[model samples]
Target: MDIKQLKFLIALDETRHFGQAATRCHITQPTLSMRLRNLEEELGLPLVRRGQRFEGFTAEGERILAWARSLMAAHDGLYAEASACRGQLVGTLRLGLVPLGGFEPMRLLSLFRRQHPNLRFQLFALSSEQILEGLTRNQLDLGLSYLDRLAREQFDSLELADTRMGLLYDQRHFSFTQTSLNWEQLGSLPLGLLSSGMHFRQSIDHAFRSRGLIAQPLLESDSVHNLLQAVSAGLCCAVMPLNGGLEVGNPHLRLLPIAEAHTLAPLGLILRRSAPRSALAEACFEEARRALADELRLSADR
Candidate 1:
């Protein structure tokens, strides 16, 4: 069948409503209905069960929808490859990043644009759940997130950095001179924590539980930067990833490593398993790999 007809079927399957599907496909309801009717006529079977409302697709329609998604993905891949061959890498590269992953996409973007100046990049700061959903829908080209609790089969992962948990406190308030402190010591102090939705926060909570302690945060925030700001203001201390974007110049802030024997978390790049790489994607990937290697070597030297 025609590619447009296949697209219509896929949209219908996703939305399960004629008007909503037509809107998604950027067509009028009548046009979508006509296309579906013509497709069914060509196949000599009713593709959808009609009733008072848009009920559901027939068995053949369900099968067609599956094949349609695969076909559309392949078609898009071919277009991307052809565009790359023309020396014009011109398409939107969508990326989702966790807020605290220490990924400097700005650096990657600068490098990518120098090579593929025509490419467009769309970056979203999203939760892990949204990143996975965007990848499944073929909306995102790459994701940067924590590796904990990730579903391995759905995406290919490349470890980019080791993120260590640490206590961020105002040195003046605590009079702590050492570089790190034990978990038990932290438990004795009032603290601020990340809100429950963030994966980093959950990891911190898990670390506390493993030590037979409870995390009772006097203040909680969804924003990592805000949490750091609070600590700088001496509102309370917070446990955060060492690689979180706080700089050393933030006079009131000090990063103290968590004393739990091992507290490093893996931060990485994730891409759909079936996604074909574009010139821009490959360039960004290579830069990330190089940066990760440098980080590892620095840690070894230390």
Candidate 2:
């Protein structure tokens, strides 16, 4: 019945382990279980399906959990609106970011903080699909993901400039005279690419397939950092974004654009379409717009 009890339930759903959920709520396992029990008694419904360990929620529990998430969102929004009225916005905005190396979310965060110094952020590195699901479930306030992947009807988006892709390699392992290399030219190189299921990897696969080619990666991983590390060790080259934290003066590495890549990856900030928008979400969107404008200005000047 109480918000605290609802929080415990939500935590349990997130962690899927009683002890971990208890730890997240800064309470002991016994207390968390007792509180949840009290909540179930108050509601007169069996919420949890329990045995020796935490199993799962009941059918009724899932319905209640959806309302619980909505209530929690409204509760946070209430506080945020009140703070905004007093000339400052405050609350922890949950942001889900699709994993893309060198995307540099901190740049946007830094800009956001300059205006709303009291506002905080909780960033999660999630896939584009995960981000969409989180937004729909009220588990996330904002998300940075691929614009092309988001449905316009479900969410409002602020699209940024396309992020270009390239081949990353150590200078000692590969030599190239041109500034860019075509996909056909990459066939013979031992490559480290993103794993099959990842969005980035899917894009790479589609591009290769469209050209009547198939990539044979020597190393495949979900983490962009891991792929970069493999390239650093001269174990293999990698396909990466040009802006993905490449060291400018590092003589050992070079990032050459994929010449035949016609469709660059589009990046954007997305917020779920809901009645009475959260003040925190709106503020975050405005800040993102400002940051993009600044970036455009800087690029135009050059």
Candidate 3:
């Protein structure tokens, strides 16, 4: 019935354990249970399914939990808006970033921090699917991911950069003395690639399939550093995005753009579209626009 009760419910849902949820809410387990019971009594519906331990929520509870998240989001947005009027934006901005190991997300966050010092940030390195899921669930305020996968009607976006796929390898390992490399050329090399479930990896697979080739990766990992390390050690070549957190000065490694890599898309920021947008989300979006404007302009000039 009250915000505290809703908070307790959400906490329980997140932790999936009564004791842990109580600890998160800074309340005793008994008190938390009493409040939730009172809430159930007021609503005349059973929210939680009872057992020896926390089993799960009822169907009704799932619906109510969604509303609870929306209510909390709106409440936080209102508070942020009020604080901004007083010349300081204060609140935690949760950001979901694709685990691309790129500098673009960090650069944007750094610029945002300088502009709004009072604001706090919680960053999560997630997959594109996870980022989208978090945004939909109201668990993330913003996400930095590939713009092509996001539904335009479901979310608003800002393109940060035009991403390009490339080949990463040690110059000493192979005889690939070319300005660019294509998927067909990469078919014979022992390669390191991201896990198959990842969007980045899926893109790589698609590119290879289009050329009637299949990549036989010697190493498969979710970590970009692992792939880079493999290339650095001359263990295998890698195919990855050129702008996805690649370090250009590595003496052992070289990144060459993939020839005719038209499938790679723009990487950018996304916010879930909702009525009465979060003040923090809007501020961050506008700030990103301003921060990237100069760079975009210079690129245009060149």
- Residue pairs in collision within model 1: none
Q: Candidate 2 at 22: error in angstroms?
A: 0.6
Clashes of each: 0, 0, 1
Q: Report how far off residue 130 is in candidate 1 (Å).
A: 2.6
Highest lDDT: give the candidate number: 2
Give one digit per residue, the lDDT tens place, for model 3 in 1-302: 78999999999998999999999999999999999999999999999997989999999999988888889989998999999999888999999887553336778878889999988899887888899988998988999887778899999998876666778878888666789987788887899989988767877888888888887899999887788888888899888777765756677677788887633566789999976468898899889888788888998999
Best by TM-score: 2
* Angstrom error at residue 227, model 2: 1.8
Candidate 2 has a TM-score of: 0.92
Candidates' C-alpha lDDT: 0.76, 0.85, 0.84
Candidate 3 has its poorest 10 consecutive residues by lDDT at 97-106
Please list the Cα RMSD from the true structure of every candidate, rounded to 1 decimal place: 5.6, 2.2, 3.1
Model 1 regions more than 4 Å off = 1-79, 102-107, 110-114, 171-174, 261-265, 275-279, 290-302
What would the per-residue lDDT of candidate 1 be over residues 1-302, giving only the tens digit for each residue? 78999889878876889999999999999999999999999988888988876899889877766666767766766777788787667666778887666555566677667767877888988888888876776656788877775778877778866667677788767668677788788888879987887777777788789889998998998787787778877789888767665646777677777776233357788777655444455556676677668878998999
Candidate 2: segments with Cα more than 4 A from true spot: 246-251, 262-265, 294-302
Per-prediction TM-score to the true structure, in the order listed: 0.66, 0.92, 0.84
lDDT of 2 by residue, 1-302 (tens): 78899899999999999999999999999999999999899999999999999999999999989888988888888999999999999999899987653366787788788888998899988888999999999999999888777778989998864666788899887888987888888888999988887677777888888889999999998876798789989999988876766645677898889876633358788999975467899888988887788888999999
- TM-score winner between candidates 1 and 2: 2
